[model samples]
Target: MDGDLVVDGNITDVDDGAAALIVLGNLRARNIYLAGDAKLVVHGHVTAETFVGDMTDKLVMIHGDLRATVSIFWNEFCPDLVAGTLHGRTLAPAYLDLSTAPIGCLADPAPEAPLSRLLAPELLVTGAPGPDDLTEIGIRGDALRDRLLGGLPLTTTP
Candidate 1:
């Protein structure tokens, strides 16, 4: 798109063949969920509360800087490349290669807790939860994934 794209709620699915979403300008959203071989290319900066990629073939390329509170490469096949600086927390499997991108504040979930239990999807979209909130009680795994796939905001307001 030409100008900045601002999404008040989450940007989910976008599972097209290639380059599902392309933005010439900046992109700002509450959260972004990419799956099913989805690809997102942002020429300008990206500002989101949370960014999650959940497919082996998924790709998220940001030419400009990216600022996200929580960024998760949920699947081992997902390749997230940030050409510019990346600022915020990131969660990824140890097997995933994120060396190409400079990630700040990488958070690893406790051994007892799986990656899915790290954060509450609803709070991620509706409230401002920091890295410390990972332990907070909330939905997770299938329930969270289903909510994201449903593409309905947990609350009417962001």
Candidate 2:
């Protein structure tokens, strides 16, 4: 895989080549291993099992989950990291920065914490189902989404 291996679809395997895997679109694959100075450059979401190799600079901005051996750049793309996990020794530099990144709160099956607890108490938030009361919750959700998308810092306090 070299000279811009652009894939508009999914890539089953990319471990055989020592070139850069540049995905122009989404990459829905598993077990991606690169060797001999291989690189990965994805312009879209990449859902994979594991990525083994030293990722180069071109490999920036991933919108999905990546359980690689390391995670260095998790904020170069959108802040809203839907679901993903970066593992390995290459994530030390970005560890502290992840706290402010969207990837920091990525919950797959939903966390054990209650949703109401995540919002401000002054927002009059609740988990119960009411007639017009539910509208307030919806508004809060919208606000949160807007803040996240706008890359604005969220206030967790009441």
Candidate 3:
């Protein structure tokens, strides 16, 4: 239609001094709006369906499908945004697959899961078939939200 643009990746650093960086080397315009100030050094799996910016241009980091619509700046780059990011609409699109599914537990994990950069083919956690024993592969929903945030320890209740 007229609202299906996407931006892959770019902007290595430019929080200030005028701002105006760009990247998203593909998939353009889903009512997009990423302003400027460059700073997307995540490299590897990159994606973007739609998202606008503030906080000096994406300083609200939370890499992994930033379905930004209009305004949602929490600073410190996605400060564990349990209720932020998702402006205009069309949430979830920063790259996901958790190997599949509703992304088991709503994605956003990762503490130290490097499984050799994974590519499928059984993600055995460690040695004698790990992952607490095994049987739950096909993970990708942003790496099962970074493995459901293993180690779990980032408070902010209220």
In order of appearance, the predictions have TM-scores of 0.66, 0.31, 0.22
For model 2, residues 1-158, the per-residue Cα lDDT tens digits are 22223232223222334455566656654334333334455555554432323222222345445533212222232223424444322222334355565544342333233333433343233455344232422323334333433434332431
What are the per-residue Cα lDDT tens digits for candidate 1 across 41-144? 88888888667776667666787777766566654544455666656666666666566433322333324343334455454433554443322333243545
As for TM-score, the candidate ahead, 1 or 3, is 1
Error of 1 at 13 (Å): 1.8
Quality of model 1 by C-alpha lDDT: 0.62
lDDT of model 2, residue 92: 21
**Residue 51 of candidate 3: its Cα lDDT?**
35
Leading candidate by lDDT? 1
- Ranked candidates, highest lDDT first: 1, 2, 3
The better-scoring model by lDDT among 1 and 3 is 1
Whole-model lDDT for model 3 versus the true structure? Answer: 0.28
Residue-wise C-alpha lDDT for candidate 3, range 72-100, written one tens digit per residue: 12111232221222322222223322224
For all candidates, the clash counts are 0, 3, 33
